[model samples]
Target chain A: MIDFERLRILTESAKYDVSCSSSGSSRRNTKRGLGNAEMGGICHSFTEDGRCISLLKILLTNKCSYDCQYCVNRRSNDVERAEATPEEICELVMSFYRRNMIEGLFLSSAVDQSPDATMEKLLDTVIRLRKLHRFNGYIHLKGIPSADKKLIMRAGEFVDRMSFNIELPSERSLKLLAPQKSKVGILSPMGYMATEKKQALSLKYNKFLPAGQTTQMIVGASPESDGQIIRLTQGLYKKFALKRVYFSSYVPTNEKNALLPTSPVGILREHRLYQVDWLLRFYGFKAEEILDENENLPEGYDPKCHWALKHPEFFPVEINTAPAEVLLRVPGIGFKGAYKIVNARRYGKLDFLDLAKMRIVLKRAINFITCNGKFFGTENQLAVKNTLLLTSTDSVILSQLSMFSNDEIRQSVLQGEI
Target chain B: MITFIFDGTKIGLFTCVFDAYYERRIPKTITDKQVQVGFYDNVYQIETDTQKAKRVSDCLKNCKTIGVLKDVSLALKSGRDDKFTVIFNYVKTVIDNKNLDVSKNFANESVLAFSDLIKQITYEVHRFKGFIRFEESVDGYYYAHFSPDNDITWLLMPHFASRFSNQAFIIHDVKRNVLGMYDGYNSAQVNAEDRQVTVYLSDDEINFKKLWQTYYKSVNIKERKNHRLMKNFLPVRYWEHLPEKQVEIASF
Candidate 1:
């Protein structure tokens, strides 16, 4: 029997991984199967840190041979180690899934014996969970850095999503922090999965990996600017067609290493990266255009607002006549807001009140857009910058203050309802 | 000056809409028969007519007013004040204008109000999907209990049904005295009080729950503890059913 102590240790070890999203897989339950994956994903619970605990995120074993400096499961770490068998993991996944505690399993291992050995064990658990146990839920398996191509490919067929953690943005940082892992070793499996998925598509075999691939990069671990980090993220998205590029703010787990940052990176940096990521993915922004090669994103304002501030010529576009793409470039006008403007404008010329009703964040947009040929924003660039900064900071504090008192605000924030 | 009390189902509400449209009478309020009318004004009881309901349903379906009918169904279960009137006016606008594009017509009051109501109910439905927790009963059936603000017992059925298709499960909505039962082959909703029983979890299941609760605790980073943020995602009301939120230390 698997004891609670071991489960606690494994879960504690797995908690640092911020990518517990159980989305993007849409597998129906076969007869005699215990579960299915929904495309929208279901977040079963929220931890105290406000992160969604969507899956049974646990490592098959915390025992490892490689001494990755940033990893808690490194060979030199003194943490107690335990290994779960394929059967034990299957049982836990089934039990938790049936009770609706988790969407599925996010099974990762610490290269206990060897990379291939760990990869094989993970593959065994997922295959058994599917064929033997008939558990057809979301499974996000971690691809061991140097695992065999066959093992990674076979694992992809069984799991919904697979990820190879980049950990550090650049190869130089990878060598400094995690000696055993390499950029080539990590990118090889991703390249294989991407090619296999394309081949599967051409062959009408949609069974390769439904959710595709996602990756995580630890921010602030190595001395890489957000510009360098985002460029790599763009490369991964373009190169691997990754489902998502997760940015985990570096938490100082080990301070002994003088190479790594002694303090954890502030979450605001991570938040800014997410905003930039959203702009890249949804708002059709090129990373190079958003930030120069060396420049870091500004702290006080979001990437979009920062971009709008830097270029004053794009401001005060007529909302009533601006095309959807132009509206999207406006700082406060999100995709949804842009769509609303296009849709509402068809009926008649819109005013600021109409924009407000559509839930457009006009605080920042008001500085950039004109309603029905009337300009409410200041002509002076300096005044506009101060106003935008005050509004952005005020909104942040306002959200924190208002969210503290109102349950609806807090709930909306969680649901992205605001 | 007139209130129409219907059977409180989506069909019943639509049937009332059909009747009100035919009669050319805009009702002061459309309320469920179970709830207090709150007024002595002229009250009419509307028995659900499938034929009448189908006419409205077909019209909306033919026009393919995407999300308008869905919003109507959600509004019926919304339990929000003046929702009936808002839905009625919104439907009237859609039918009158013959416009499927009224969804984004924020300038229209009824459309705006109905959209807001639908957004709320939709959000709640999505949240409940994540918030619900279950325990294994002695019969090996998974059972969960939830108290949702909206009458979404039937609404949440398809999600859980597709998820646990192979397993027999029961999701009881404590607020509305409803239960959604999903057998291995089929699924349906029933009155909770109609079928009552004492259920005891198996020892193995209980131990797993303890482990889950323990895991939940271990996963939280104390340095970044944000009670406000946690409550934002998992509201305090939902804490009752979650095994992780239990205060008792695990005996195992």
Candidate 2:
């Protein structure tokens, strides 16, 4: 058995990938092998950081030949390294799954010699977990860049979700920082799988990657602004029909790297970006509306507040008359709140008082909305902003926002481990 | 001389703590009305007597504060304004001196179901107790915050205080925004205030964050990193605490 020390290293190494949603798979458990890939396989449990602990998150090995400077496991870096064979991973995953330690397997690895070689080992383990072991569970397999499309496509069929990280926001950053990777190397496979996911789903292939594709882009590593990152995020969601766009904050592991930030990218900035991302996807606000290409997201307020403050002309929208889409544009009202307004308004005209009963954050919305032609909040934009900030319930609102959108909030809501 | 009176019912703005209670328990039984709404109407005065509201609250609070009453509510967790109203109304009938023992009198399936939910929420908090990992801030403070369903924030105190006894650490329930600070010997839990403790930005965690990020990026499968799946697992909302979420330049 690999020692707990090695286990910790391997699991911790795989923590940042953020591509492990065990929602859909059809693999079955074999008597000899240890697990299965079911839609319900990954029972995610989270900590305050919103990192999921349910999947037996591990790697085939941290051993690598590729020298990606951003990675601690880069071949040049001297770190405690370990590799698990196809069978070793199978046994560990099975044991962990059986003991109910995990809901699924989130497996990845550093490139040992070549992308193909690393990917083949990853596939071999998944294939073994399915064919030889007949283990069915939720398996999220990471796609190796520059790995053969045939192998990548094959693995796509077996895993519930597959992700190819658009690691940096742009190709130049990829070249400047991670010279070994290219625009084509990471994106070609992603393009192929997006099509494949579409084809499989279009055919009503329920057995296909049910959770679908997602990609991560490192924020603040390159010279990209929140607007650019968010625009690319919008494109990914729109063009590829992606389920999510993850923004991993750049942690300066190697201080001397010229392309990377000398210091860590602030988490609050990353948090604000996520809020903007939500507005892009769920809120009617476009990336351009949230922020211009020249500007970054406001450090003090979220993108929604920024937009509301910028366009005072949109303020004081009647809650009863405003459509669901327009209602969603308001800072305080979320998707649920919008739905409640739409539903409840059918009975009668809604006022500020009615909105309060619905648990709506009228502090932010009241300034922008009129109830029964009555306005309780200040008409002055600055006054509204000050009042909102003054009466602002920081933890409560952040907590509520986190509940629906924040990964950290999901950790608290999502039940079960593995 | 002829006199006429106008009457109608209207909902009003503003609410005290007990508005939700009346919204649920008060029957809309219009058994009696003095006049017609099309012409002369009866003015329905909105209730706003704080003293009267307090009496209703005092009774309800006493009924709810009892563990047995809450245990009977079957919410599975602490009654934090949701579905508690349902139970509060349902329990009102039997919440008296003659029927104080809820378990003995009404130990039905509703009670059992709520108990199960409580158990499930308890299990989740316990799991978080083991799963939460905090990075060392520059100032030698270990800060980890989570917004759990239950008051799992307190559940963490005994374990973390004993585990990191020598360290000054804070486990903030980001959801509740109430932080529990363990100063080695004593644990004082409080809400986040600007003047209280340093609302130090992410700069504090930057000094020692690289190793974790490096490890994180390295292990991503070049073939299969699903951003959506990852978001589903560890949503970006948590990225604020995770040292790695800030920035990473992919060194090709």
Candidate 3:
């Protein structure tokens, strides 16, 4: 068994990495193998910070050679260091997995000795877990940026997903905050992995990174607007066919560094960035359409609502006749809600009551939609905006107040009765 | 008003549907439990017939636009009291309008209620897949104890069976008094009312549990402590079986 202290140190070092999803892979268990990956991943637990603990996220070693200023495990930091062998990690994963403590293993490491050596260890651990241990569980390996391409490729074959963190959004931020890491070094491997995955799929070799690649960027670390971040994220998704782009709000870990901000970035900014990211990925939104190059996302309104408010021409879309895409653009209708409306409308015309029964947020969407040409929302744009803002804040306060109430109130809140 | 009483099985519910159609008397309400019968009320006890139930199920299956039978099955597993009536009405609608996709017609109260019940059951099954915590026993088997809001122990069997193909495990639903057991090669469920099994932990279980608890603590960032969000995902009800949430040794 792995020592408790070593596990703590490794886990604490690996905690800041926000990507803990075990989704996107459907690798079935082989005969007598330990586990299989579910397509819509399983989150075994949620931490105190509300993050899903899908995988046993831990580091092989916390010893680093690179001095990235944003990193707690930087070479100059005098934190307690610990390293675990491949056998130890495999044992921990198998035990925890058998007991159903975690979905799988998320194996990341610092630049212990060199990038090649670190990547080699990670590769060795995964290979042993797959071949020797006969474990068919999900494994998300963090790719060492400067590692040899062959090692990274070999590692990809055994793991479900791989990621290389692009910690800062801009190259300038990379130079200022994480000096040893380069934009090219982080992004090139991702590009290579994407191409390799494509080639493997074309050749019918389906075992290479079944979950594809993901990357993370630290928000508010250096000076980068939401638009800049969104643009970079759009480029990553389009260019490399990346699966996800996670934004970790910069937490001030280090002390008195002139380059680093002493105060941590607010969690609300991170939440807004995630909202924008969802719009880009699922809602068919473009970064340029969402925000300008230098503009940050507005604090009061969500990206989708803000967009809808600005474009008054799109309002009063007929709920019965609007296409699926137009319905998706409505402020209150989520993807599921829009799908429900489209499907339900095929049988009969949907009125406000029907929309309410389907659980569509009518308060925000009422301004944008007309049920059978009967407009209930205000035609005044400014009034609509104010109402939207007012209702949004009202719901927030209501939810906060409901938190202290009984389970019945909480259930009502969940059902959107409030 | 008439009440059609079933035996609380899928076939029984289908038999109720079969009776309502063939007998030409649409019951006012359908249920599985005993209820007060007034002097003017008509009560019919549904005798489950394999042939009649199969015919109704086959008719539902023929509606290829929607998986009506699947939805009925899931809705039947819900813990709600009105699940039978909701499902019966929804199934009757689908059978009556076989050409039209009645399941998509959310405007219909029966379809809406049935869909909501199915959604609740499906969501609970998914949540239990993650929330179920297995403890290693000294007898070289794994055991998990949970009290889910739905009759979903059997639904969880295939997932855990495939995931832990080599391990022998038992999932005991404390509330329902049912046990879903897997013997490495096959899975089965049995009703064990008021059954109790003492599980002695393996020698290494404590060590691993401590390691997991420590890891859980270390991973939480003090700077981003949001108990509300955490509770929203992993509710307080589920914190019972979670080792990470148990305060064994309070960290001062």
DockQ of each: 0.67, 0.04, 0.73
Interface RMSD of each: 1.4, 13.1, 1.0
The positional error of residue A61 in candidate 2, measured at the CA in angstroms, is 1.7
Question: Tens digits of per-residue lDDT for model 2 on A11-104?
Answer: 7667666655565455544444444444443333443344555566678888877777776677776678877778878876654443233566
Best by the TM-score measure: 3
Query: Tens-digit lDDT track for model 1 on B1-252?
Result: 788888667788789889989987778788774555456677788889999999998887766357667777678788676777778888877887675567777766677788888878888999888888888888888888888878888889898887787678888887777888988778888876756645687667778878888878888887677888888888877777778887632342
Tell me how far the alpha carbon of residue B141 in candidate 3 is from the true structure, in angstroms, after superposition.
1.7
Model 1, A71-172: lDDT tens digits are: 888888789888888899898888788788888999898888788988998999999999999998899999999899999999988999999999989999
What tens-digit string does per-residue lDDT give for candidate 3 at A1-418? 7888899899999999999999999999999788999999998888878888989999999999899988899988889999999999999999888888888999999998788999999999999999999999999999998899999989988999999999999999898877888888888899889999999999988889999999999998798888788889999999999999999999977666888888999998999999999999999899988895438888877889989987888788999999998898999999999888998998988899999998899888998899999999877554566556634338533335344786745665566655
- The A-chain TM-scores of all the candidates are 0.92, 0.87, 0.93
- Deviation of model 3 at B134, angstroms: 1.7
Best model per DockQ: 3
lDDT of 2 at A362: 80
Off by over 4 Å in 2: A24-44, A47-50, A388-418, B1-252
